[model samples]
Target: MISPVIQEEATGCGIASVANIVGKTYPEMKAIANGLGIYADDTALWSDTQYVRTLLKNEGIATSDNEIPFTTWDNLPDTALLAIKHHQEDGKDFWHWVVFKRIDGNAMVIDSAAYLDSNTRTDFGEMTPKWFIKVSLLHESSFDA
Candidate 1:
């Protein structure tokens, strides 16, 4: 039930995360991202939060305005975009993007890296998240319907 969209490119984790959150395929999100001039190859896509936020905004999804520092996995919102595998290169910070979801009171992570044998993950003990952006599935305008 948690089929993650695999990143089609080496630097496409951000795009893939957006796809997973929005229920779109990698190519589908990639096309929209390209149309918005948000390319995966841009280093800012991973090192900065704006790109992912922008993509989500364009799709009518709402995310927290600020990055919340990681505390405990149990404290994460029902859905979130988590930053893991963090490191600095040339004094710039970078991280891998993954989606956290709570379904039927069960939590699992969706990782887009193509190297993973299974993308739906539950080994939370193995990951060290640096921060996260809480994803809201509904836009304020949704209530207008």
Candidate 2:
């Protein structure tokens, strides 16, 4: 389980929230994600499935066939929930952290980084393979819990 303090910190401030916790800007976070082999582009075409898979693997998390099902949002696992909550609390949007775990039914969570700076809250939603891949590959790791 994620610490309550961390969770509160992440959910409290917007971009500045993560900046305070991780001591880095959104752009810097993108660079770190890119360095970890994760793509960090928001206006790209295809989803970065490989990049997201690589990041999960690097973090000791595993996925089947290097792909996360888009429909796994109905029942997300605890780990994924932790990840999403942490990222969301930290004000992450646009970018995303996708996770595939089987704890609470076979489901995935799409934690968007765009919400960090978005003026509206409708930008974030359920995990889709395409969106998951794109955001996962580009999501900043500096904010990872």
Candidate 3:
């Protein structure tokens, strides 16, 4: 699980407001996350291990050149939290925040986002690649071990 402090830093009150709160640059934060074994990539809209490694490299984390399994939404690890963009039918983009709290039951939760209007919340089961960017964060202990 991500530390409360780090989680607060990563997922600020709102996406727009986050820009100001996430003191570190996007690349910098990404690097820090990568150092902690989080996979932050901008690949083919999917979570491939190689793609993740590439993303880590892009964020300045050194890694051995190797191929690895890609992580799918359905296969994400329990210790991971994914920040994805959820596309709406009307063509507008909605930011979706999801924490992989449990993998055994194939369940996840969409916490909240800045783009949501007042009194609205999105769920993990209600996400799609069209509207969301797939970013993952790994637990500190998991990264250390």
Candidate 4:
């Protein structure tokens, strides 16, 4: 099982999520996020997807161009950034970020929530994902090569 990167701040799940996907430490990811003006204290991140997308882009990681409505775990891509614990507030959308990866027919979620005893969650029923951004790590040219 892949080790999870526990979020260092209450609102730093976004940073930790990025770190989890990119194999960076929480502090390391936080510094990079801060350098890009992406702060955890900003609640705007809860509703905005661009910040996380931008962070992934900076690391040359590609994600789906648009959000895809989540159906079932079996339908999810091999790797994706999922939006769970979704809710609407003041007419804006907010959701927690979690990473999903399926390998060898085994699927699991890497949640950055600091309070969770186990960051690697496999109980799919407990999570309700609203949508997902497919994370494609390989560059297109890699397929050509």
Best of the candidates, TM-score: 1
How far out, in Å, is residue 5 in model 1? Answer: 0.5
Backbone clash count, each prediction separately: 0, 15, 7, 0
Off by over 4 Å in 3: 1-71, 86-97, 103-106, 114-125, 129-145
The lDDT per prediction is 0.92, 0.32, 0.36, 0.88
Candidate 2 regions with alpha-carbon error over 4 angstroms: 1-31, 37-39, 42-46, 66-110, 113-145
Tens digits of per-residue lDDT, candidate 3, 1-145, equal: 3121122333332221122223344445445545655432322213333433444344443332332232455554443334455444455333333333453564544343434442122254555422222233322222321
lDDT of 2 by residue, 80-128 (tens): 3122331222343333333333333433222234333422122235323
Candidates 2 and 4: which is better by lDDT?
A: 4
Q: Please, what are the lDDT tens digits per residue for candidate 1 over residues 1-145?
A: 7778999999999999999998999999999999999999999999999999999989879888889999999999888999999999999999999999999999999999999999999999999999999888554433110
- Give me the displacement of residue 58 in model 2, in angstroms: 1.5
- Candidate 1's C-alpha runs over 4 A off are 138-145
Stronger candidate by TM-score (3 vs 4) = 4
Q: What TM-score number comes out for model 1?
A: 0.94
Candidate 2's clash total is 15
- Model 3 lDDT at residue 83: 44
Error of 2 at 63 (Å): 1.2
Give the TM-score of each candidate. 0.94, 0.34, 0.29, 0.93
Count of backbone collisions in candidate 3: 7
